[model samples]
Target: MAKLKEKKALMIIAERNFRDEELLEPKKILEDREIKVTIASTSLQNSRGMLGATVKPDLLLSSVKVQDYDVIIFVGGGGASQYWNDPLAHSIAQKAVQKDKILGAICIAPVTLANAGVLSGKKATVFSSEISKLEAKGAIYTGKPVQVEGKIITGEGPQSAEQFGEAIVKVLENLPE
Candidate 1:
């Protein structure tokens, strides 16, 4: 297979309690495709995963700009729920969408997308536990593993992380640089 022409930057944005599987699985998939994956967070010291694992970030949200990437992904977990309304998280989601970059949110991270005004009137799928929250924010909820509507893509939960990663890869392959 010819190498994909498009280059994607997988942005894994997590909080202190992000799920390990949700972030790692997708990241591994993207990197296997030779796409650059950057792990960014609210802070840079270290963030704890949902299962009590520790993860380091490649960049800090305060330091990184969104336009440098072709794709921006939000990793979801219990920690994301607490920080979904964060101004910095919201800012990244909003700016990525505004720039027409491929935006993704898995599990509870979709709440951040809703908070960023990216899901309004768009068909999306997120972890079912928060479907009502997304709907309340004007999202058209789809109860599925992965849903890609335009430049935005969302996955249901950790169980669907692999599919979500593949979906993102497919989208990246199709989009021109």
Candidate 2:
């Protein structure tokens, strides 16, 4: 038997509105395994979810250092579009890819990654409304509830949040220890 290496995950949510389940479901899955989860957002104030789950961000997105975590996830909602073309979000996504850290997004947040140029040639999925944006970025849209391609993971929407979290944990657990 061997002790597992500690893992840390950074979850980015929208300042005003994020999908509650998308953030909570995944955060629970990761924390159950004793993995540390940090919440980040565009602002340092409390973030309100679409479903009314208010969360205080631990840090601002502009201050994130990709090297500090094993995974980086963007929680999606109607407001997730705020990061669709955001340079800071795109830069973070690119750095995560460049560093080979597990990258994940649920619902519409995948659009942020697609726009970041890291989804090119990767298999991914997103909320139906965002399919074209992913396809336009050269990502093969699989339309699955949850899709895991290499170290990148994407979920169709809130209903897929749990499976998305499971997929991320699977990837993290299987990484060379």
Candidate 3:
């Protein structure tokens, strides 16, 4: 708890149509716990959510340095699919794992982690529609609202955002320094 006050988290969102709750809920919970949050996107311009929320990203996704943050999260929506095959996004996910940072994805965004090859053999959950794709990537789909495997967390959808946030917080609280 003492060290969590200085924890930092990087949240990646689609430049358009990121799920509102998926991004907002977890962010609020993390902030409430004193975790610093930074927003990144493919485009730095204001990004809009599917439900009409908007965010001005603090940095370009391409400009991100994985080592700067203790946690990395991918917010999901129809637009999150844009990252599913993106090489940079995949590299970020891989680096997060290699660096021992907490990593997360909500809704369809978990597909990006799956595609990045980090989700293989990990227990995860994602938006219902992408179940087969996640399974194809060698992930064990738990069908839970939120699944936490080691330092990786996956949320089923918008409804699971709070649980997803709490899961990350719980892990951070228990993380070995």
* lDDT for each candidate structure: 0.84, 0.93, 0.96
- The lowest-lDDT stretch of 10 consecutive residues in candidate 3 is 1-10
Model 1 misplaced stretches (Cα beyond 4 Å): 1-6
Per-prediction TM-score to the true structure, in the order listed = 0.92, 0.97, 0.98
The residue-by-residue lDDT of candidate 2 on 43-142, one tens digit each, is 9999999999999999999899999999999999988999999999999999999999999999999999999999999999999988999999999999
What TM-score number comes out for model 2?
Answer: 0.97
Show pairs that collide, candidate 2: none
- For candidate 1, give the lDDT: 0.84
Task: Give one clash count per candidate, in the order shown.
Answer: 0, 0, 0
Decoy 1 TM-score against native: 0.92
Better of 1 and 3 by TM-score: 3
lDDT of 1 at 1: 34
lDDT of 1 by residue, 45-161 (tens): 789988877888988878768888888998988888755778877888889988998899999889889978889999999887899889999999989899999889999999999
lDDT of 3 by residue, 31-115 (tens): 9998999999999899999999989999999999999999999999989999999999999999999999999999999999999
Question: What TM-score, to 2 decimals, does candidate 3 have?
Answer: 0.98
Stretches off by above 4 angstroms in model 3 are none
